[model samples]
Target: MKPRTSMVILFLLPASLFYLALFLVPAAWAFYYSAFDWSGFSDTMTFVGAGNFIRLLTEDPVFWRSFGNTLKIIFVGGFFTFSLAFLLAVLLNSGIKGKKVFRALIFMPNVIATIALTTLWAFAIYSPRSGILPNFFKLIGWEAGTKFLWMSPEHVFWSMLIAIVWINVGYFVVLILAGMDGIPLEFYEAAQLGRLSIHYGVWKTPAHLPVGLRHCHWRDDAPADCCSQYRCAPPDEARIPAILGENP
Candidate 1:
């Protein structure tokens, strides 16, 4: 083999092995365990073949609700996240002052741990009695907002969706902003010189503009007061069985 080919294999070898061990092995184990009925505390796992899957699909109302919530996170959460991120990216890219400061402020949440961020939302922001929202509403004499129960069953799903969006929007803004910055200044100059419209110039940039125009597609969900990916979060009465136990 060529020396360059050998060097490429040496670089990729560790990552390939890491993926196989951490992701592939665990996923396979989860699939194997899904065929059984186990409360997760017992020594013996009962072999029920497709019984568990059948119950989840046809008989479980909680499963259906969590499934619906997942869909909401994919669609609704994605919409808000991308829209806000794109807007912020555009504003920042337009020669805004203190761009670095604004970028750091927006991305600060991502610098902190996810679990810590969730705790802040649950206790500091969403707590009805003494939380920020309630206190602000009370100060403004908005009685309904003061009395709102954000963590309550009826509102918890939407509340979580909002939190998830806030946590992820910053990272996407950075992504899209980098792409926008790659676009040549000549395009904008052409627009300013009346050789092209601003819209035409931005839209017509061949390579880099497509990266900026691409929509955010985030699949991971945050864990705040409940599991996002597992569909075990509340608003559904009962918990879904932990058969597979948090698969990626």
Candidate 2:
């Protein structure tokens, strides 16, 4: 409607067209092929009319298992990853020694390739015969009782979940640390300066400090993690939603 907007669209149109041609055209072709029965190398495509979809829905236990596994990883593994990351972020943000070394130690795993990490975990830690866990248990005099088969199919899902958490937590830890760092240093100081009092128990932080303070009549794990909301910077708001890009 506006002249400047029209000119901006005109300027953006070429790149937009190029992107659509590069991405959407091939995606459309793939969608078309997905409905047919054809070897990828063959030219003839026998249209199956949702037959693949029907088979996948009604007969694919493997697919459903995979779907369930994905959900479990996303929720269960995600919970540990995010929770531990937040804890690590808080710990690292506090005045501590070897902060940089700790940060690097936590984050360097993320820089390594997933395949490389998998190889290390599989061979060095989870391998049934010569794995580190079994060997370590033996060294600790519990080999007979603790000969855990970590690489077995029954246990591999848990291994996968561990691997997923290990790979992911570092990145989010760094991210949350960055967000925590963005907050004014005064808040952290206030949290540390909280005086011991009977009102809120051990120590009562000022309104500006979020970490240790909780509303009266409400005390639990929920309030401790949700302290960013009980904070004063933006009135009452959770930093996690902001850290994860929900409130941002």
Candidate 3:
């Protein structure tokens, strides 16, 4: 039997109110404030209906550049991150030995403080003199590669994109893996009985079902993904299976 409308509303009401209180209301206030010109510290607000937006669009090269970077992170970085996560999640789920240990190792970067990761990337990985990449290039007799400055303006954005992808891929991998784990083992057994490759079934079947599509359901989680590149998981998020409970 279908749930009654009242029952549906009763279950959703608490979350709906929370969303309005925390997100929608604040967003509405921001949209309202966008119509005015006010130094956030000033007592006076000057009404400049759409003028601020006009200035942002026409008079701001820096704003446009930053906006472009945001788009790049969303599209370019997201593609690499999710693609790698899907491939790794599939491989990791293929009855690999020590899978739990591998998962923990992959997830280590996410749990670490972001500043520490940045420092490691800047000094140990990208540094021109003694960094890993430079030295590897040197060892390979690639002088031009050894001298390349990864932090330079020409390369910094891509470097940051790579770091963002590296830090966040593990979390998504774990998420996809969890979804795969939810699939009935009998499904795989049935596939095997039909002389079908289990790996193909795992990848192909889930892609059409809720398991694969779950990651695409909420793009608003972008804040969590983007900020995670620079911050440790929040306290509640650090609770292992508790965080996983949302997806489950």
Using all chains and alpha carbons, the TM-scores for the candidates as numbered come to 0.72, 0.70, 0.65
Query: Deviation in angstroms for 210 in model 2?
Result: 16
lDDT of each: 0.74, 0.74, 0.76
2 or 3: which has the higher lDDT?
3
Clashes of each: 0, 1, 0
Worst lDDT run of 10 residues, candidate 3, spans: 210-219
In the range 53-171, model 3's lDDT, one tens digit per residue, is 99999999999999999999999999999999999998999999999998988888999999999889989999897689999999999999998899999999999789899999999
Between prediction 2 and prediction 3, the one with superior TM-score is 2
Tens-digit lDDT track for model 2 on 1-248?
99999999999999999989999999999889889998998888899989888998899999999999999999999999999899998898777898888988899889898899999899988776667888888789896645788878898999878988988888998899888879876545533543321233444455654443333323332334334444423223343334333445
By lDDT rank, best first, the candidates go 3, 2, 1
Q: Which regions in candidate 2 have their CA more than 4 angstroms from the true location?
A: 1-23, 144-146, 189-201, 204-248
Residues 111-181, candidate 1, lDDT per residue (tens digit)? 88999998888889999876898889999999999999999999988987888999999999999989989
Q: Which residue runs does candidate 1 get wrong by more than 4 Å?
A: 38-47, 189-248
Instruction: Give the TM-score comparing model 2 with the true structure, all chains together.
Output: 0.70
